[model samples]
Target: MKAVVYEGPNVLTYKDVADVSPKANEVKLKVRACGICGSDVHGYLGITGRRIPPVIMGHEFSGEIVELGEGVNNLKPGDRVAAYPLDFCGSCEMCAKGDVHLCLNKRAFGVLDVDGAFAEYICVPAKVCFKLKDSVSYKVGSIMEPLAVSYRAVSHAGNLTGKNVLVVGTGTIGLLALSCVKAQNPRRIFVSDLSDSRLEIAKKMGADTVINPSKENSLDVIMDNTNNKGVDAVIEAVGVSATVKQSIDSLAFGGTAVWIGISDKHIDLEMQKIVTRELNVKGTFLYGFEEFRTVVEMLNEGKLNIDPILSKEITLEELPETMAQMAAGAGDIIKVTVVNND
Candidate 1:
């Protein structure tokens, strides 16, 4: 099997590797499409410690089950599926409550402890795999993970019907968050980003207003649009001090702010203001099992528009160079997917 192996910081090697065999109660899948996430770029740059070297780094993927391990039930070979990357201990308290993402013993594919789908084939727990409808393309199936993350963040924001919402950053997650917020029939959606290309894409994707903070003031634009009152909800997709601050400052009184981005930097927060304004600030990591299943259903029903968010598609051989380019911020690309054409 050929895979894009992460050797070290800013290093990726495309070479043949040992084929993976499914364990008991697992399935071996021939990968069809795997999307490159922002976290992957960060891992390549050694910014995030999530992607350790000597591992295949991809979790947002879709593939066909070529083989099933002994004891695997309800699914068989030739099934088209997308998998939830997190594997948790079923006996844990969090898992018992169906909050698997919070399980104390959790191993995330392409991240913490598991090898992932950056190759021709990979094995995953049969329980994590969900069958995809014929109407959902493999390209779209690869995006279910991030879409699930966006859905979870929006769900944290509670009811958005006829409320103003602000999404910070126009990256793939932010764009997907925008789409999820729109589905709730929000009165207006404001998107902020430094990239004009991404902002344009957000506009095309139904953002009520797009603000390039580099040129214009995003806070002013948001305030003016909402008649001087801040937005009712904010989704912070950029995990930076500035963006985190912006998310907190852009919320209305008693409004909700959900932080989905991951960053090590700490920001100074006005605890007094938070208390006075009665703001609801929450941090969301990954999606739970229910959110993951809901995202797959939404994709199958064609309720989410993911076409504009896909920027490029490349082969496995092109993955190393593409990761380097993404780490260097070379292009205005939003999302890149690696397809196995073999």
Candidate 2:
């Protein structure tokens, strides 16, 4: 097997590794396409606590089943499928409630205590494989995970129809959230980011307005667009400390702000605004497979057009250079996918 291995901080290499064998109730997939997620960049830069070196580095993936272990009966070889990526203990209280992401024993591929798909083949639990139509290319199936996160964020935040929503970042997740909320047909949407390129992408993704705080002013643009009233909802897609505060400021008197990004550390919040404005700020974790499957349907039905966000595709060997570009914020990179094995 040829895969991309994390060497150390800001380092990656393509190397030939031993093929993986499926455990009981698992299946082996021949990797066809995999998307580069922000967490992969975090782990590449050694900023995230969960990612350790000497491991494969991709999670948002789709492939064809090459083999199935004992006890696997629902699927067979040659099935086109997407990797659910989440590993949860079905016995936990959260799991019993159908919230596997919150289970105490949750494990995610390419992030925590597991290997991942960024190679010729990957082994995953048979339970995590969801079949995709032959018409849905592996490239498009790879997007199910990111859109699933957006779906979870909006679902947990109640309604968005006819509400003015402010998305406080224009990354892939932010852009996806913009599109997801647009399905509800919000009154207006304002997207903020430091990069004009990303802000442009957000606009095409259904944001009514774009904000580049570095070039102009986020508060001014958002306030002006909302008829001097703050937005009805603020979704924080940037995990940095400053953006968290900005997300708070974007809220209206009785708006909700959902934090969708994973931050590095604790950042202070304005209790006064939270109390006086009655603003709701909530944290949404990953999605259940059901929501994930919903996102896949949306993609296949053409309700969600993610084609504009895929900036480039690279081979596994190009991951070292291309991933560095993504980490440094260079190049007009959206979601970089590995299209071929090393």
Candidate 3:
């Protein structure tokens, strides 16, 4: 198998590697499409604590079952599938509570203990594999992981219908949040980003207002637009310390700010907001197994159209340079997906 091997910071190579097989309760998948997630960038840049060197680094992917191991009764060869990347202990308190996302001893495929799907094949636990509906494309199936994250974000942010909502940041997840939250018919949707290109993409994706914070003061603009009342809800997709501060600052009194993006910094909260204005702020992780399955069904059912979110698609060989491009920020890109043309 030809896999993308991450050697170190700013280094990756497409090289031949030994093929993988399924475990007793696992299935071997022939990977079709894999989306480059922000975590992958962090790992490639030697920032992600979980990612170790000489690992296959990808988590968001969709593929077909090329082989099946013993005891895998529900799935067989030739089934189209997408899987939850988390390998849980299944006996921990978190797993017992159905909060498997927080499994204390969880192993995230491709980043933690196991090699991931940045290759021609990946083996995943049968229990976590989701059967991709025929109506859904491989591209979207590969994206179920992030959409599941957004689903969790929406769940925490509460209902947006008839409520003013703001999404700070127009990255891929930010845009998806914009699309998913709009389904609730928000009274007005505001999205802010430094990139005018992504802001335009947000507008086309249903954001009612787009603010380029570079030109004008976003806090002033939010105050002016919402009549100094602030928005009813804010989704912070940029997990930076500055964005965290901005999300709090732009929020309305009694408003809820859902932080979805993963960051490297230690964030300090504005404690006054919790007492004086009675605000609600929450942090969400990856969705449960069921939520991952629901995202695939939604895309399969035509409830979500994210074809425009893919900024570029290239063969696996191009991933090395593409990773560098993604690390360089949103220059000529939004989301780059690596595909198996075969």
Candidate 4:
């Protein structure tokens, strides 16, 4: 089997590696498609520290089951599915509360210790697999992870009906967040990004106003469009100091800001603004199991249109070069899904 192994900062080697097999209560999958997430780019650049390499790094993936371990009765071989990448201990207190992502024994694929779906085959717990509908392509199934993230973020933003909402950044997650926001029937949607190309896609994805901060002041554009009042809510998806501050400043009094991006670890914010204006700053991590299931069903039911954010499709052989381009921010790429053509 061949996998793209992360050697060190900005180094990825495509080489043959030992094959993997399913453990008891797991399933071995013939990986069909995997998407390059923003976190994967950060790990490649050694920025996030979550993806301590010399490991296979990819979490958003879809595949067909080739073999099922003992005791796996919910599914069988030949089922096309997308997996919830977090391996959590179902007995933990957090898991008992249904917050599986916060379980102390949780292990995420492609992060730290676990090898992931960047190869031709990978094994995952049978419990994490969600069967895809016949209408969902492997490419679309691979994107369910990010779609779940966006859905969780927007879901925590409370009701957006008839309220002005702004989304900071227009990357894959940002653009998807915009789609989730649109579904809530917001009065208007504003999107800001440094790249004009991404903002153009955001416009096509139903953004009422798109602001390229590189060309002009985003706060100024946001204010002008919102009648000098800040937006009613903001979904911050960049996770940088600058964009984090922008998300806070572009909010109206008592507005909520649901942050889902993780590009930056530390951000200095104005404590006074949060205090005086009574703003709500919420930090949403990965989705709960129920939320993940909801997005999968939404995709299956054709409730969300994620076509505009999917930039291109590549083979596993192209990951080394494609990942470098994403890390350097060189291409006009948005969301890239690596498909296995084996």
TM-score each candidate: 0.92, 0.89, 0.91, 0.91
Q: What are the per-residue Cα lDDT tens digits for candidate 3 across 177-218?
A: 888887778889999999898888888888888998889898
Write one digit per residue (lDDT tens) for candidate 1, span 105-220: 98888994468889999999999999999898888899989999899999999999999999998878899998888878899999999989888999888899999888998889
lDDT of 1: 0.89
Which portions of model 4 miss their true places by more than 4 Å? Answer: 46-49, 216-220, 262-268
Report clash pairs, candidate 1.
none
- Clashes per prediction? 0, 0, 0, 0
Residue 58, model 1: lDDT of 96
| RMSD for each of the candidates | 2.0, 2.5, 2.3, 2.3
Off by over 4 Å in 2: 47-49, 240-242, 262-268
lDDT of 2 by residue, 186-234 (tens): 8998888888888888877887888888888788888888888898888
Runs in model 1 deviating more than 4 A are none
Worst 10 residues of 4 by lDDT: 326-335
Minimum summed lDDT over a 10-residue window in model 2 is located at 333-342
TM-score for candidate 2, residues paired by index: 0.89
In candidate 4 the C-alpha lDDT for residue 184 amounts to 79
* lDDT per residue (tens digit) for residues 1-342 in model 4: 989999888999999999988899999999999999878988999887877778999999999999998889999889999999989999989999989989889999999969999999999999899999889889889988888888999988999999999999887788888988887789999998888888889988899998888889988988888888999999999899999999989999999999987877788888999999999999987778888889888888887778888789998889999999877784778889999866
**Candidate 2, pairs of clashing residues:** none
* Candidate numbers sorted by lDDT from highest down: 4, 1, 3, 2
What lDDT score goes with residue 131 in model 4? 93
